[model samples]
Target: MQQMQVYARVITQLIASEDHTVQDLNSAISAVLRLNNINKSESPQHLKRVAHYSRLIATNCADTYSLSEEWIEHLYLFAPLHDIGKVFLPEKLLTKPGPLSPQEFERMKTHTLKGRDIIDHMIDSFGYKDHLHYTGMLRNIVTHHHETIDGKGYPYGLKGDEIPLEARIVAVADILDAMLTKRVYKEAWSMDKTLKELQKLSGSKLEPEFIGILASHKQELMNIRTASAE
Candidate 1:
């Protein structure tokens, strides 16, 4: 309990301190997750890649999305936190060897809402008051990222543009990385295969525009993978 209080204080310091840089924020996120026992083998790299992919898509589609530089940077910072609630889930559930049972899947779906609650609790408890500014974007990314474009997603059936732009962007980033990375239940898919899979999901499960934007930056994505690989 005392250690948790210390962690909470560190989070407060990281958020409220003006001297803290992005790297500091990243390190704090990593340390927190490590303490919580996420999949140490792949979680960090997955987070880094999603952050990079999100920033890449946001920067490339800036004019269309009306994304400012500040927004893009914040997306990179918060993208990793999108799955923070996974720490609240069980290890067996997270690393299940195959398809989730119906009950398990329902439980899994709660992570998004749980993530939102965690962020809110942290902000309220620690008084991070718009930490780095635009904290709502973080909440949006954490909560709505799972909502599909076709109104088929969980927690809320938010459809079409009803989903926040930040959430859409994070969703695309997340799906791309998840498809490319090998997990306990699946092998790492080839980049070509991953793109094809994303293409299939473009209109229904994900925003098509961001997927197209991601596809256009294949080379840079490769560089990101190389740099962020576990």
Candidate 2:
């Protein structure tokens, strides 16, 4: 995901106003999400699922991971931005019904890096780069969610626990949502099949512990998905 310089300028203008207030910052983030089609009309509740499952997993594993309540809330708010880079991609590539060409796949992989730059720009526009705890967490998810536990994943190839916890957590939520939802390339998968496929990826493409945590709350996740469908 090379920088989508074209969108950067437009999005910067959209976010260029005062962001000192919490309301202003939230509005800016919403504007960026809208540009990327993460809002309700565009994504058909995909962002809702990601945000719900991210929080669901964190809440279920809070004791194990020692996650503070505030951090859990942040994951809910920020996890959906993982695919913000797709705003830069052409519509044909985003909805192509077949496997991407090697060239296309390469272009697609840059979304994570591009997403990071988007967050960086947002933080810079807010003039609060000095206070980066929240922004840093968002940037980590944007850049690292696709990364795997093994050194095989893209962009930086960060292995094992080296990837940020927030990204690792969102990776599971993102994959789960993709599996349960129909896309141009594939039909929605059954819950049983989705779980088995994810199980195969555990410890290699995903954190085994988080997968287990998600499995333990299978009913809750299904409930969330069901609600999204309605």
State the lDDT of candidate 1 residue by residue for 138-161, as single tens digits: 779889989999999977999999
Q: State, as a TM-score between 0 and 1, how close model 2 is to the true structure.
A: 0.84
lDDT winner? 1
Q: What stretches of model 2 exceed 4 Å from their correct place? A: 1-44, 131-133
lDDT of 2: 0.76
**What's model 1's TM-score?**
0.92
Query: What TM-score against the true fold does each predicted structure earn?
Result: 0.92, 0.84
Model 2 CA lDDT for position 219? 91
Clash counts for all predictions: 0, 1
